[model samples]
Target chain A: MLYLALGRGAWGELLAKVKVAAIQARPVGGDFRHPGNIRHALELLDECFRMDDEVQVACFPEYFPWSGGDELARKAEDLGMYVIAGLAEEEGGALYNSCVLIGPDGAILGRQRKLNLGLMERKHFGFSPGRELHVFDTDFGRVGIGVCVDFWGPPNVGRELARMGADLIFNPSFFFIFREVWHCLLLARAVELMVPIVAVDVAEFPFRLGDKVFESCGGLSCIIGPPWRDLDDFASWWYEPKFNWILGQLGYEEGILIRELDLDLARELRGAWFSRLLGREAPWP
Target chain B: MLYLALGRGAWGELLAKVKVAAIQARPVGGDFRHPGNIRHALELLDECFRMDDEVQVACFPEYFPWSGGDELARKAEDLGMYVIAGLAEEEGGALYNSCVLIGPDGAILGRQRKLNLGLMERKHFGFSPGRELHVFDTDFGRVGIGVCVDFWGPPNVGRELARMGADLIFNPSFFFIFREVWHCLLLARAVELMVPIVAVDVAEFPFRLGDKVFESCGGLSCIIGPPWRDLDDFASWWYEPKFNWILGQLGYEEGILIRELDLDLARELRGAWFSRLLGREAPWP
Candidate 1:
């Protein structure tokens, strides 16, 4: 239960099903309006405190703010464990699409906003949306709140946060859009919410994603584990930025895209490879 | 009327409504006693008469007689055009998947037999489904026929050949089942038949679709037109004969991928870049 990730350059630990991290976006926009990206998010949380061991969970990259920084929520309550980010809220005057979460006693455990804005986020930087969705109870069990195109491919808000019983399911995305619509809509909302998706995107977003976009939102910062995970099984992950190609011309993806899901092979590739062949009584409408 | 094609490498060609060609199959072990590849139709009709130009119709890929050539209908009457190839016939004793349609005055302007034969063409040949369909009106117009998973993508026979009018729809494919089915189902059947397709595949057979099973079918040859083309235009023609590689390979791109169909900017990309606002109706259905 200690995975960890934050690609764009380098960062990985993934011992198996949990630890998770990931923060590669470098767009410098999204509300707080980049202050050199909060000094690169405090130099990326001082390198996620020398790469955690037991409990971790860094995550970021949906709004990437700092314009006001209430001491950046007291630096994730002094970086204890779960930080989870994505910002750009504005309350009354409008402009939402937030995320928040912070724990390990850093406070805040619930925020969620972002009800499918996308498509140039209401004509670039206007945000709005987030109507209902709160979920979190965490320790490790019932945590919820899907942001970023509200858990895409319409997995009805993570199947209504797994019918309001959520086991995990954070989301964080800034998916600049298009890449086979993020793997056929976020890997079919982590294989139709059986649960266990950590997701986080934005590995170097300053621009450019046109050559038939296969980037702008993928390195599959996935942590998802539940039915089907073996993109040719190589232990998982590829959205590298910060490192790989020597800072891939400054875009990002340092490192991190690991996997070890044995949550019963995600319930046997989603109940025997897609519930006896594309479940819900298959045969697409 | 210089719409020539007859390729086997990059992506084949054929337009009007849409036409792709190739049946270059090889695993005779799939039985039907292997026959029609006529030495890959005289080495892909001598590379389409060294880069075809005035054909108006040309295709071939399925089992071009399992590469056992000598007479590709006298090289389609010495390349006068109108070929539409694919073969593996063997009548009476059963074993169709054919194509024919010679013309350039060579005659036989029709023959189609391949109404879907997947799963190793229903276990080692002995096919049997294409009970009828010739549609060759000529002078470059009503062309029709289907084979190799008849334009698969949820049982679609090009809207029953544009509701039986078909201005052009030939498709002699081998779409290389492997090669990452190139982004799910041949670019969604060339953006759902906006017409003018020509998809051959089998640039280099002779075994090694990794020795078959689990996936083989090579080549990628494609050419989808109409919406003024851009499913990422291509042109290589042929390859897959030699080499090892950690990263070491080059040399192979037969020719002919031409597009120039300003046919009035494909009718001004039919109102809003085509997806159904189909201005002049992509050609029926």
Candidate 2:
């Protein structure tokens, strides 16, 4: 009764399930401003769409689109699917690293600009950090997005999204090093927030920048859910005869990782693990 | 100059190097209020002391000594080593899960009470939570301690300790279930705060609670440090010749995990990674 009251009644019908896909793309080489790079990115998007016809929402890696938001929106509209793609937007001579969520209606539902800037982004690219964080309401559920480094900083962007009633958080990252750190951080964010996370990372990309060569994105994209184990013994946890919670995971390769999230299970676990601790009316509610 | 200035001035001599140990002990069964359990805990402490004589600071698992705070303090003075051990304290008709740092001078330097309570703790034990967080300054460095569940919460207790100028955070955890979450959270807290962490977990202990028998603490104690790799290529971040930052780690077994931490390296990396982003004057400073 408490779960139903706190978990937005009509939990079964209103939030049935969502099939999501994370497209781990290989990094683009040559001039990033080149039109050919944009074409290559679109080709990857087409591949992702073809990989799974039932994927209601598809996510791409950070800075995948070179330009042309209108074309991307039109493509999302044609496919009748929600698409979250990361790109760099130049406005009034200032560039902001941003993630745009395009609705099935071909309109931009929301945009989350990267709040934290990496060393290279600040000194080399002159990119200005974003000031606001936003969560978008979609057909499946409320969702939030955070670009690569934004998820890495203190006052974690994912936690803020979880606080904003996001059932799922999408992290589009371009982490080129410390693959172990990326995996660990993703798990930390998921467990800490008690929310499902779909994190898409870039594949191994070797590129020369001036005199230095950069490689290794280690595309280990994954879909993580809340606590799935129940205590069978007072000391040990037992997870069996239940759902195989880890939907899908990929490692250091360009692939479309798709999984159907059990929204009901997420809500149930959140209630059992987090909500009950804080009393009936949870902070996220 | 910026690193030295932001890093509290003393570059080398004062905060040179520290050898630390995390002792993962099996929990004492029967009555938690038993005196024999306290003697058993002292035996484990003796084993840890015998394991590494060079270890300046050693940490024990949560709720090691069933009682006797003065005995633990006297042992630390006898060994001439700083010791952090977890125990439960009864004060003013209320029970609190606490971790006390015993100075080598046979004095109780400080005690950190567990801020968060687990489900079983709240329901079965009637444990009252602590309100304040404290960091202790030892001869080696500024140290902070968190008992079990306190380290698992968001706006991490370890991060708060780091903000309080704690160079090394000792997380004495009794995580019996979800071993993967424990490992990931420790790594996440370490990397996010850019501070070294020595997390001592309990070994597998099977005990009967009512009708069911639960087993597992899964020892896996580890000493993790700041970023170990220096980029061979600024853009690629490829490590050619680098020191492995994780000094030592133990599997799910009763053992002493010892590692020498280079304070200078931690301060340097903190400066390189975190300090430059927020200008020169860090909030921690």
Candidate 3:
């Protein structure tokens, strides 16, 4: 079992502030097997890097490409940033929906396979579900990744990650429809886990096979922090419009959203609200 | 351990449609021990019953009254309606934050003491938390109640109720602050549990103790149903202005919200989305 690294080492000290980006990409023209899909993903990654030089980490939509993992790692190494990208992998004759975490050193730090499978992934694509959850240690802080439906599962992969000492969670989803539902679910997860969430989905995707045509993934990448209020005036924190702390959000268009998150604020709010229920000590610490 | 009654019997056959009401009341002048608080709650109940004659079940906010359980039961029996009301209870020398269910026969069918407690409730009020989760079989269907923070808990009492065969869940909340957070959590619970949630909070409450003048418990009582889309076109469901199926929602004012929920639609969507993950057979069935 891969648990979160909880020791008060350099990582703990580095949990001050980090700039994160969620990249909303246009759908690749071809399927996962096509080289065009990988090329398109690389192009989007390049755009994200060019858009924000201060982004310490960038996340892409799910099922971008597994073949592009090494290339993404190399880019991360060159830019000195962490990269979380989604792809489908073939391991031991079984296909799995996965996301790869590449560190600043351009090393594949870890991979999180999707635990819950949709009907299309299971019956149409023959993808096997994942069995384990892992939290990765990074230069900035401990992070966890839940690919798409894993965040929607009743078992709550995000809550488990927070319990393991993850200050941040990244959800790479292909929400396709019901965009409002996606937003509501992400906010709920953030509040329950008492952590920050960077969830990205494809802006627009058109699936055409035989006589069927499916379009509109509704790309609305957003970043949500823990619920907080003004310490002195509790009423002002909720009534005042300025206290609405959705750091950044993107509309249904191909773009990259960058925001500097105050990890200290999230920590303070978590302590005030959830420390009693979740406990104060970090498991690994 | 209590599980949802899932067998296909007369109850299953009766799961077609039910009219429900969520009453958003203004805070009574006195605390739980005051007669004015009970009078205010009874008045609100009268108004709700008058507003919707066909409503089979009605829900009230948390801490509405402590002395009206018997009266509320008698009223429910007279009207032939199920009533779920929130109040504080003193039992065996312990104070509990609780909600009571009154059957159509005017009997106190069951009570759900809150399982989670906040700082004010635990420290200032010296209230002890409840230790059990239950689902009640009513004339309409299986229903569960979670007072305030239990709906916000990570374990998700709402999901447990849905698993226990509850077609509907009532969340009696006194969400004094963070109104948007309340909306997000309610929508998230509805989507995750695949069940309708009728969450009621005080319309507006002003507390004046010494120099502290605490005002505003924004009332935005709402009823949310299962996530659904048009079978012909998926994009139409989200993009169409009329597709937002929040039956009704109130602003920051005292009012009653009534909606007719199609349980058959919820059951269909649950079978389509959650059955694969949660399993088709109910444990109790």
Model 1 agreement with the true structure over B1-285: per-residue lDDT tens digits? 333333221234334332223333343443213553465456666665565445445666565553332365677667665676666667678877777777755667667877655444555444665666556565545556666456533223654664564544555555433334332343344343444445555554434222443334345555555432332221110011111100111111333342223332333343223322122244222
What's the TM-score of chain B for every model shown? 0.30, 0.84, 0.85
What DockQ does every candidate get? 0.02, 0.33, 0.30
Residues A79-196 of candidate 2 have per-residue lDDT tens digits of: 8788888778988888988889998778998788887776656776677888899988776777888777667545357767877778888888776556656766776666567678
Ranking by DockQ: 2, 3, 1
Which ranges in model 2 have alpha carbons more than 4 Å from their true place?
A1-16, A27-32, A153-155, A227-245, A275-285, B1-16, B28-34, B227-244, B275-285
Best by the TM-score measure: 2
Query: Positional deviation of A278 in candidate 2, in angstroms?
Result: 8.3
For residues B78-154, what per-residue lDDT tens digits would candidate 2 score against the true structure? Answer: 88878887778889999888888888777998888877776656665677788889987766667778677567556
List, residue by residue over B1-285, the lDDT tens digit for candidate 3.
Answer: 122254223444454678998988776562545677767777777787788888888888887766677788778887888888876789899998889888777888789998777655676567788889998876556788877778855545776787677878888887655565787777667656767788888787664434555565558888887546433232234333222546688887889899888766666666654544333322111
Clashes of 3: 4
Query: Which candidate gets the maximum DockQ versus the true structure?
Result: 2
Candidate 2 vs 3: which has more TM-score:
2
True-vs-predicted CA distance for residue A165, candidate 2, Å: 1.8
Which CAPRI quality tier does the interface of model 3 achieve? acceptable
DockQ metric, candidate 1: 0.02
Count of backbone collisions within predicted model 2: 2
* TM agreement with the true structure for every prediction: 0.33, 0.85, 0.84
